[model samples]
Structures are given as C-alpha cells and as structure tokens.
Target chain A: MKEHATKAAAFIQDEARTNWHDESLWFVRSKRDKAAHGIPEWEQLRELASQIKDHTLSHLDEYLEAFEAKAKENGVTVHWAADAAEHNRIVHSILQEHNARRIVKSKSMLTEECGLNEYLEEQDMEVIDTDLGERIIQLKEEPPSHIVMPAIHLKKEEVGELFHQKLQTKKGATDPQYLTEAARQHLRQSFLQADAAITGVNFAIAETGGVVVCTNEGNADMGTHLAPLQIHCMGIEKILPKAEHLGVFTRLLARSATGQPSTIFTSHHHKAKEGGAMHIVIVDNGRTTQLGRPDFRNSLKCIRCGACMNTCPIYRRSGGHSYDSTVPGPIGSILTPGIDLKKYSGLPFASTLCGSCSDVCPVKIDIHEQLYKWRQIIAEEGHLPTAKKQSMVMAGKVLSRPGWYKMAGKSARWVTRWLPRPLIYNPLNTWGKARELPEAPKESFQEWYRKNRSAS
Target chain B: MSKAHILKAIQAAKPVPCPLPVVPVFEAETPPTREIFGSVAAQSGSRVVRAEDFVGLATAVRTIYPKDISIATPLRAIQSDIDLQQASPADLNGVDVAVIPAQLGVAENGAVWVTEADCVHRVLPFIAQHLVLVLPEDRIVRNMHEAYAQIKIDDTGFGVFIAGPSKTADIEQSLVIGAQGARSLTIILI
Candidate 1:
C-alpha cells in the first residue's frame, strides 16, 4: 500500500484542493459534534449501541441465518459474499439475472470499497451513479473524495465544463442549480429507463428483513420505485435487529452529517412491492474480521456518518482523497489497516490523532484511540518506515536512562542551533512541511521542573 | 470475514439447518406505567402531550392536524383520506409525512423500528401529507443491545423503528432533509 499511498499523495498534491475538501468535510463533522453532544442521552445511547453490536457479533451466525430466512420469506433474495471480489461478482450475477444493461445506483460506500461500478463496467454493464455528487465525479472519471460529497474537489466552473462537454450545455454556463437540475432531469430518465436499481442499505431491520435507503434527492426511490429489479448492497454491520433504532440513528445521522434536522428521503424496502424483485447482497469484506478484533470492532457501529472526517483536523488539512480508500478520515485510518497492512500502512500514521472523530462520532467510536492502536500494531508488524522506527528507538534509549536523557537534551539543543536548517528539515516526516518546526528553548522544561522542585 | 461460500459449502455438506430462532415475547402484560413523559416531547419536532383516552387523543390529533386536511385512525386506514384504493405508488408519490406504529426500539442507535402492522395502511404513511405517531413510551431503550435483547419478541405484523424523521443530505454537499417520505413529523405522545 506504500505504492498506493505515494500515488494518492501525488493525486492530492496535483489537485490543489485538498484543503477545501478537508474543510468542507470538517464542517459536516462539526455539525455532527453539535448534534450528538447536544443530546443528554448521547453517551448512553452510544454505549447501548456498542453493546448491541457486540452482542450481534457474538451471535452473528444465528442472526444472519434468521435474517436470510425472513428476507427470503419477504420475497427478497439474500446473497452472502465473503469478500470484496465475491461481492462484486454476486452483484454482477444479480444484474445479469435480469439481463440489465443499465443500472442507476445510490450511495453505498460498500460498493465503493468493492469497486462495484468499475467491476460492473468491466462486465459491459452501464452502472450510472444517480446521486448528484456521484454523477459529478463519474463525469470527471474520478473517485469521490468525500463519501457524502463525491465531487468536493470540483469547482463550479470545472463542473460546468464537465457538464458542457458531456451533457452539451451552452459553453461557459456555470450555474450550479441549473446544472444540478439538468443533471436531475437527465438522470430521472435513466431511473425510469433502467431495468434495475442498486442502492446501499443505511440500516437493515432484522425483524422485518427490510433495508432502509436514505437519500436527499429521492434518487433511491425514483430509481427503486420505477425499476423492476432492485439490488441492495450492504455491509453485515448495518443490521440493527429491530426498527426503533432507526429513529435514533436517522435523527442523529442527518443532524450530525449536515446539521439538518432530518434527511429528505428514508425509504424502507420491506417486502418488494408486488412484482419488483429485491436482492440484498450482505458483504463482509473484512467486517467480521474487524468485529472479532475487540479494539477495532466499534468501527462497525459507524453508520458511515463521515462526521469524523468532517471534523478531523488532519483530514480537513489533507483531504479525504489523501486517505485513498472507500472510507476515509479518522475512520478510514483504522479500517484501512485492518483490510491490508501492506497497502494501507501509511493511513494510521497520517492522522494527528486528534479526538475530533470520536467527539463527533454519533455512535461514539473511540476513533483516535483506534488510530493510536493501529500505529502500535503497524510498528509491531515491522511496517513502519526506517526513519520513524529509528527515531522511536533512540528516544526510548535516551528517555529510559537519566544519564542519556540529560546528554540527549543538551545535544538536541546544540544540534538545533548548529545543524544546518536544511539538514534539520526531515523530508521523511510530513510534519516538517508547511508547519513551522518550533525552535528549541535555551533550557528544557524538565530542567526547570527539577530546579523548582529543589528550591521548594 | 468468513466467506459466505464457506457457510454455503458447510450447508451443502452437512445439510444441517440453522437453529430455529426463538422469538422472545416481551409482552409481560405488566401494568402500564404512564408517570414519566418521554424525550419525545423534546425531540418530536412537534407538540407532544399526554391524553387520557381515544376521545381526547382523537380530539388532540384533529387539533394538531390542519383544518384543510382530513385525518384517520389505524395505519391501514389511510386510504379513506384520498381515493388511494386504486392509486398507484407513482400516483401516491411526493408524500410529506407517514405515521406508522414502531415494532420496537434499539436504544443503541436511537432508532425506532416501524412496520406494516402499525401503519394506517400499506401505502398510508408513504403517501400522505404528514405523519403523526403515537407511541407507548415504555418502548424506548439505552442502546441497540437492549433493543436487540428485546427483538426476540414475535413479529407477526409489519413495523419500523423511526428515530426521528426521514432524511438525507446527498446533494452538492448541501444538507436538506425531508426528501421523499415526509416533509414534517408530529409525534403525539399519548
């Protein structure tokens, strides 16, 4: 994943809009914080939710079996996928079952992780992302930088140009609302024409064997309501056992995500209406592995509420695209390493370890603590860069012994004054770039503390 | 994640049916506790006040509803408000609110599950002007585990656990709620 990180860094540097992307998401994160902490019962709610997920994880085999049976009885086909590859294949098979050439899809971050659209394209299937932000990025032929706001990197002019070229708009027309409406009109036809609709499950009620799809544009409904075949993709973690949880999550989800009191559309596809066929592909894709690991399992409670990303200082500065995964920001930093240590080794280290993600987390996942844990795990696995490991070892050796600590503190002061500025600057550390390296004081705080202690 | 195929293969080799689920009946017939008002009064985004019986509750529902529109009881009884008997879903599109009975709660996520059983009718809430849900307060929980703990109950009817109102913010980063389901919700805490 070092290679991918390099590529992602290069991509981000070239975009020159990482800060804007970061800040935009951070704004959402702040709103989430306001909403979540605003509730007096917020912390209690989080604990209960966490315990429920733990309980679910322990008896997953039973719940999944029950869910499958109930869903089948409700006329929804349940497909199980062990991994991303299987998930993509199963989705394709479902589309093929109906010989659907064109499909309109809603926002399902799981599909992004599985690379579903690209895979379906390879199979000669036309899968158009109908979400407005998704459509913008799809037009640009880029991955969504932010999960909720896919085209956060694009400016109005850029979007106008893309629309002009693809949709043949009048040259230089940059009206966002007009372009959005036009896209809506254009996509509505696709929703109507498409034979199948593929959507992401927000929360699936095990009791009813139904999946809930939340959308602002009502695209999920426009497509699913019209399309004869519906394909729903969801992670195993989306299961919430009962329905009342929807009230808490839906209230908190929108408010935390964007400070909205509620989301525009929250449609539940219970038993498929009449002749419409519904197929749910529950993809694990490292979730149960994540679930079994007690430390990282709380991440499963994430409703993919990108609030943490929105509020993360590191994410806001570097941007979601910098994380280079389906899920990004503080949440991604932890989830990525669990998926592949080699590929996503840089993620955990990328964070500033600020507690904003956890603070803003509606379900209260200890995001920063997990990031810290991932760092130790990575270092233990020998994935740390040589320079970081060496620095840590040297610091450990000096700090553990008083004699070396005194000598090291004096040497560090001398080095700061004498070493060439260029030599002092570490290209290996991202912290050195842009941010000012604080000058070493004439005396260390520890030295002052010792003197004060003696005088007292 | 254990590959689903592994489970599938296990099923094929052993032909062992998964354990039959035991639906824990939470219906203890305990005396109804009506002393405390729930957080609904605060979060309902509408007026929530207690009522003694059907006469006062129905009277309150009528007062809360606009004079121009009609109201009805029973989730399945929504068809009388309009000639929706033959109205297709497309015809019933652009509904503002839906009031359906919640099956239970998963305090974990602050969600309230609802189902077909609690609605005025199948298409009632999804094809209406607004929704007003009257829930029994004892159903609330601390988190999802507590909710899950109680989910072993029988589900002989349709239900959903609505946390707040239907919502989303998927537009050009603009956060707009009340998309397809209901533009507003009025929870009458009876």
Candidate 2:
C-alpha cells in the first residue's frame, strides 16, 4: 500500500478542494457540538456507551453464543466466518442457493473490508450499492472515502460528470437534488429487481436476537424490505447485551455523525419479514486478534459514527482515501496497524497527536495515545521507514548525552547562520521543504540560564 | 470449528471484567408540545401538520401533493391511489405518498415509532417519494429514553424510529433532501 503522506500529497494538489473538504467536515463537527450540547446527559451517555462496550467485549464469547442462539430461535440463519475470504464465500454461497443473480446492498464497510463485491462479481452476481453516496463512489469504481459519507471527497460537478457517463443523466447538471433524484430513479429499478439485499448492523441486541441498522437515506430498509431475501453482515464487536441500549446509542450515533437528532431511519429487524429469509453473518476477520492486544482492543468500541474523522485535522485536510484502509482516520490508524503492521506502519505517523479525535469520539477511543504507542511498536519491530529509523536513532544518541547535545545544538545554530539557502533547504530536510526552519537563537536556553542565574 | 477457534481466541485475549455502568436517566424539562415536534421534524426536513381527525388528513395530504401523484395508504378515511395491502413491497416502487400510522412520536428528535403491523409492506413508508404518518397528539413522548421504555420489541417482528425525510450531505457536504428513500416526510398529528 502507498504511504498515507504520498496519497495525501496527491489529494492536496488541488488546493481549493482540500479547503472545501476541511471546512465541510469542520461544519459537521460544529453541528455535532450543538447537538451534543443540547442533551444534558451527553457525556454520561458516552461514558455509559463506553462502559457497556467494555463490559460486552470482556464477555464477548458468552454474548456471541447468546446472540447466535437467540437469533436461531427467531428463525434466522446465523453463520460464522473466521476470515474475510470465508465470509465472502458464505455470502456468495447463500446467494447461489437462492439463484440470486442481482443483489442490492446498503452501506456496509464490513463488505468493503471483505472485498465482497469483487468476490460476488467473480461468481457472476451483480452487486448494486443503494446508498446514494455509496452508489456515486461505486459507479466511479472507488472505495468509500469516508465511513459515514462515502462520496464526501467528491464535488458536485464531479458527481454530475460521473452520472453523465454512467447513468446518462443530462450533461452539466450538478444540483444534488436533481442528481439524487436521478440516482433514486436508477437504483429504484435495481431495488425492485434484485433478488436479495444486504445491510450492515449498527447494533445487534443480544437479548432479543435482533439487529438495528441506522441510515439517513433509509437505503438499508428500502432494499431489505423490498427484496425476497435479506442479510445483515456484522463484525463480532457490534453486539450489545440488551435492546434497551438502543436508546443510548441511537441518540448518540447520528448526532455525533452528521449532527442530526437521529438518522432518518433506525430500523430494528427482529425476524425476517413475512416469507423472506433473514440471515446474519458474524465475521471474526482479525477482531479476535485485536481483542487480544490489551492496549489497542479498545479500538473495537468504535460505533462507526465517523466523529473521529470529522474532528481529525490531518484527516480533514488529507482526505479519508489517503489512509488506504476501509475505515480511515484515527480509528483506522489504530485498527489497520494491528491487522497489517508492516503495510500500515505509516498510518500512525499521519496524525498531529492533537487528541481532538479522542475527545470527540462517542465511544472515547484513546486514538492519539494509541498512535503514539503504535509508532514505538513500529520502530521496535523495524517497520518504520529506514530514513525515519536512522534519524530517530541518531537523534536519540545525541540527546542522551548532555555535552554532545549542547555541542550539536551550538553547531546546528552555526550551520544555519553560515550555510547558503540551497544547502540548508536540501531534499534530506523534509520539514524545510514545505516550511522554513526557525531562525537560530543567539544563545541556547542552557547558556542563557547559566549566565542569568549564576550572576544573580 | 471456526466458531470454537474464534471464541477461544476471544476468551484467551479478553480483558478483566468491567461491569456495565449504570445508565443515567435524562428527564426533559419541558413537556412535549406539538410545536417542539413540528420544529424538530422541520430540522430533519420533515413537516408536521395538525389535523383534527382522519378526514382532515386526506385534505392535508392532497394540499401538499398533487392529485396525479400516486398516494398509497393503510388508513381508512384517506383517499389513496394505491391499496398498500394489495401491493407488494417491490410493486410500491412508484408510489408518490404513503400514509401510515405511527405508534408514538418523540418530541426531542421528531421521531415516530412505526411497526410492521402499521405498514402493509415494511417498505411502504420508505419506498414512497413522500411519506405521511398519522400520529395521535397525546402519544408524543419527551425523549428517546421514554419512547424505548414504552416500546415492546417482541410483539412486532420489525420496527423503526423514523425522524425525518431521507437525506444525505455526502456530496461536498451539501444538504440533499432526498437520497434513496422518501424525498419528504409529513406527519399528520391528530
């Protein structure tokens, strides 16, 4: 995978688009603040959510069995997949059993992580993403940029252009309403004809053997309710002990995501509708491994609200696609490292260590702290870039010895003053390329302190 | 075999037990009002209409949508172009408006509790271009906590808390009223 910084540089090449993306996410962050402030027990609710997740994750084995048994009693077929490949095979086999050639699906990052679409296409099944944003990116043949808003990085004109090419919409039409209406009319046909629908579970109630899927577009419900067969794909971490827990999460989810009171639709599916078959695929896919890591397992507490992404300075500017992970931003940085430490080592360094992401997070994942921890692990495991490792090692040696450090500091100031512009701002100096180095001080802090304090 | 392997991994890696925190109860200071419901619903791109009874709902829905539009309903008095009971979920794709009953309404978010029993097809409320819900005025609750306390999940196989019209701000964070579901939502409060 390409380093995040390399991809971010490409994303930031268009200066205007970067600013638009940043400001747009910041606007959502502000709306989240307003929605959160309106509720007096917002912080308490967040803490409760965190605690509930902690409790459930601690007893995951028991709850998983409980949830599966209950779902089976409700006449739902529950399947377990050890990995992404197995998950894809199971879903494809189910579709094959029903002779389903065409399928409509809502936004499920789990499907993206599993590469389900590609797997299904190879099996000669057509998968149409029904969420408008998801559809926009899918038509463009790209992964979703943001978890909540899939096509958030794209401009209206780009979407209009994409629609022109794919859907044959009127040329030069960029209005979201007009574009959305076109998508609706187009996807409506897919929904009506598709043999099955698949959705992502927001929360799986262990008590009732049911699942809740929240969506602003109501795309999940529309597709699932229309199709003859419905399937919900959920990671093992999505379970909650009781149905009453919906009150806490439902209030926090949309408000933290897009800053609404709630998503337009929070559909609870207890069983399959009349004659339809409802299936639940609970996939492990490295989650069990993640739970084993004491420091990073809290990462599983994420509700996929995208609050961390909205609040992340680097993510807002660099764009979500830069991380090169299914779920991007701070959460992805923590998550991706555990799954593939060598490939995603650069992700942890992509942040400013601002801790804003943690504060804004509904489940309160210590994102910046985990990023710091990952950096140390990456360095220790020799996963860090060679240049970074070498420089850090050299700096560590110099900083360890006081006399050498002072001499080095003095030489650094001397070199900055005497060296030519081209010599000082070379390719090796990564910080100097985009920004100028700070002017060398007349005296080091030690020198100034010694002179002032000794005489007094 | 996969289940056992996965569960074994989880059991081995599991952290020490942390008890679930006591959920705090949030009491709304202000009583539920029709105005609060209307404004909150409006914030989510849904309109709230006050009607005296079922007969008035027909007039209200007609005023908002043209007569040529295909209106579907499970309600008795509302004049509808399509009978939802007779139409399959997929067949209701072209429906312009669907009038359904809501079990209760929450004032804080303008969410209305809708169950499968209230809908002829589970997709009726979502598939329509526009939706109208007839909720009794007295059924409005203060917040979601109250609504959940009153909800019986076992009785209905399916249910949803619909807050507003289907929406998305995905494209450059521009607010789009309609995405894949109903373009608009109208709640007829009687």
Most accurate candidate by TM-score: 2
DockQ per candidate: 0.11, 0.82
Would you list the C-alpha lDDT of every candidate in the order shown? 0.66, 0.90
> Could you tell me which 10 consecutive residues in candidate 1 chain A have the lowest summed lDDT?
A1-10
Q: Candidate 1 residues B1-190, lDDT tens each?
A: 4445535433332212323223322232322232222343234333344544435555555656646355533545343344444555454444434444555533323345555556534445533556666665667555433554565323432234444533433444543334434445555544
lDDT of 1 by residue, A239-315 (tens): 86666555456656777776644454556776665567889998877776776576887787788767777777766
TM-score of chain B of each: 0.58, 0.92
- Candidate 1 positional error at A217, Å: 1.4
lDDT score, candidate 2, position A57: 98
- Candidate 2 Cα lDDT to native: 0.90
On residues B1-190, what C-alpha lDDT tens digit does candidate 2 reach at each position? 7889889989999999999776655877788888998899998888888876435877888887866378888888887688666777777888888899999999999999999999978999888888889899999988887888888765688999999988887777788887888888889988
How many pairs in model 1 have backbone atoms within 3 A of each other, for residues 3 or more apart or on separate chains, i.e. clashes? 60
Clash number for model 2?
0
The reply for model 2, stretches above 4 Å from the true place, is: B53-55, B66-69
TM-score of every candidate = 0.74, 0.98
